[model samples]
Target: MQTHARRALATFAVAATTGVLAFAVPGAAQADAGPSTVRITEWMYKNEATAGEFVELTNVGAAPVDLTGWSYAASGGGPGQVPLSAFGEVGAGESVVITEAPAATFRSQWGLDADVKIVGGVTHNIGRADDVEVYDAAGTLVDQLAYNDQGTGTVKGPRTDGVSGEPKTAAALGANDASQWRLSVAGDDDHAWAATVGGASDVGSPGTSRFGDGRDPRASDGGDGGDPGSGAGIDPHWADVRINEVSSDNGDTPVGDAIELVNTGASDVSITGWLQIDSGAAASATPFAAKLPDGTATTTIPAHGYVYFSSTKGLGSGGDGVKLYLPDGPGGTAGTLVDQVSYTAGQAGTDEGTDFGAGAFARCPDGTGDFTSVAFKSFGASNATACESPVTDPGAGGGSTLNCQPEAPRAPAPCPPPRSLPRPGPAART
Candidate 1:
């Protein structure tokens, strides 16, 4: 009875449609055609990867071209793609892995560089140590991966390293020869650290690996513009919020409600302008821009990983009240602050309320205890009826504890552990 007693809040809906536009591959390109070069001949078990685990891809030129949807990025994050029917064709020279969880658990060891044999449901899981990057449809990033771990000073894989001279053979997994490597904070020749080769890393036989060079040698034009400059921008301390206590179904109404952004840090932040919901209302407000009314704008937030937003795209379905804009500053306002919530109607149960409910949306931004500070419930309720944040009221938990609940319906949580890049000692002559 008061979700909007004040009135006057309309201008913030610019997303008629903008989702299919990812393809940026460029740290080094030389060959061309349709599927004529392909690379990456080995990789079977990355020592047994288990901190967050991993698996990668790339190389569809020298005659392959069937890596399927082919997508991965995380040095700065964005474009996970890889659902090319799951995996089948991959001919020519060959090379396309992608694994960390699904692939039939390891179906006899992940298989397929040419050995063939991977036919179950075909959309497994894919996640172990994310923060990947490998666009190329037209978005253009070409290559990038680096969670942490260079060991021998610079080796995301076995691209050859007689001693950091870099160039042992296999072209170092760059230019598309997949080998599932991942390492770079600005080390090795810097192609962002290209190596990639997934499908259950047991990679032939090795002693140490993890490289994915290629951070931007000026290949330029990653397309898909919302503009964070494309360097993978980020700074609010890495942001990483969660807040979800409920309350805000009718009065003061801004529109449904929900939050969650987590990147923690490893590079790639660009929620575009940050602030999923700052209610201070206007110290400099505009913040929330991971955008997804269908316009889908999330560029990258890997590191610790997390990217949800809600207010009833499901559950009891009852939106209106999330305006955190900033896309990247230029004029739309700069967008600041960083915390807000109050969506009850149907209170996040499904329709994809960004996976709300089930409790989660509080990582602590200011809104205190129990987290997600708002209150008011009753939409189809049942996680105890949801709503928490508000105890003694230390500012009311402006935001932070990582809360997220909409009314149950959960089953999509498998990516979080990547953070280990630091071993490259020398290499900068090209």
Candidate 2:
């Protein structure tokens, strides 16, 4: 979805991509996102009913923002666009709204299924729920929102006919807009993005956000709390793993490897009986990697020090498809597992383990599951390591350093059908 953030004097758009098509502008970073000198204070309803409610986009920027020929609509559904050319240029901090219908008739005309956005040439829509964002002029994002059917807030309507307190007040908007929002579940990315009090924003909340504890808005019932990172007691800890080297031709499995682990947590995590591997599964349904047997592995995680492990000679020759399993903890089932990186056999060098990229995975040659690089800034070393083992163990010590063969790319097979894990629906705002 698109998200826009307002700066002190500028606003930039956030770009997202799907497949080969890139949506929004490219290379726009938060830093590049200037400022929005203007801020949208609140939604103004023409009538007691919010059906006629219109968003006021104030230009707090230094220069005037052209609203000429601009169009606005509800995100979900409605008449295509509402022209704003008649409204003209919105001076810095000056408010302008393009409402196409009368107050009482608004809902009948451009109901809630619609989205309101700035449209000139390209089409961009705001997030459907709370803390959601839409791309601003510069493609930045504005967040921190409250949406419909909130557990902690009030809900507004199809349109409230009763005239109450100051309509634009944050409290009033929260009360009214809250119910108007649709309940939503946290996405797999563990995030939820939706509308706030203002239709001008594209900001959305995340699964971990205080607002992400409820149910899907579409659900007939109020809510059913599920979703990970919501309440499940998986303590958030940072673990660093490194890939020193890889080997080829080890018994049945052509690909064998070793990884280093470092516990960045305050407490020592016992990985004694644990195993590790990447995501994705092969035909046999076996996870591709593991931690070496307890004796063969490093047991205690010395706070910030490092631990190491080797795949159980089962990881195929290529890279990726790894996971971690701690088979001995009190609640030990399959321990937390993470994906490191995608490896290309022939393209990478031999023996010398490539450096994992930057970000969370930088410490390890294997990229973090998030796919952002964290370590191995070296040029060639940033690539994967290709090893070829003619015989099992040369008995060579030094942490199972295997002589890697250079180059060999594996062909991907057809992916199996989609299958759901034991996971449940995402968390809702509670």
Please list the residue runs of candidate 1 whose C-alpha ends up more than 4 Å from where it truly belongs after superposition.
Answer: 1-57, 60-329, 333-430
> How much is the lDDT of residue 337 in candidate 1?
20
Query: Total backbone clashes of model 2?
Result: 87
Worst 10 residues of 1 by lDDT: 7-16
lDDT of candidate model 1 versus the reference: 0.30
TM-score of 2: 0.32
Candidate 2 segments whose C-alpha is farther than 4 A from its true place:
1-205, 208-256, 282-298, 325-332, 335-339, 347-430
Residue-level lDDT tens digits of model 1 in 103-196: 4443332222223323232222222211244555443445543221112222223221101112234445543322343222111222211121
Best by lDDT: 1
lDDT of 2 by residue, 182-242 (tens): 2111121213221211111111121121221222221122122111222234332323323
Best by TM-score: 2
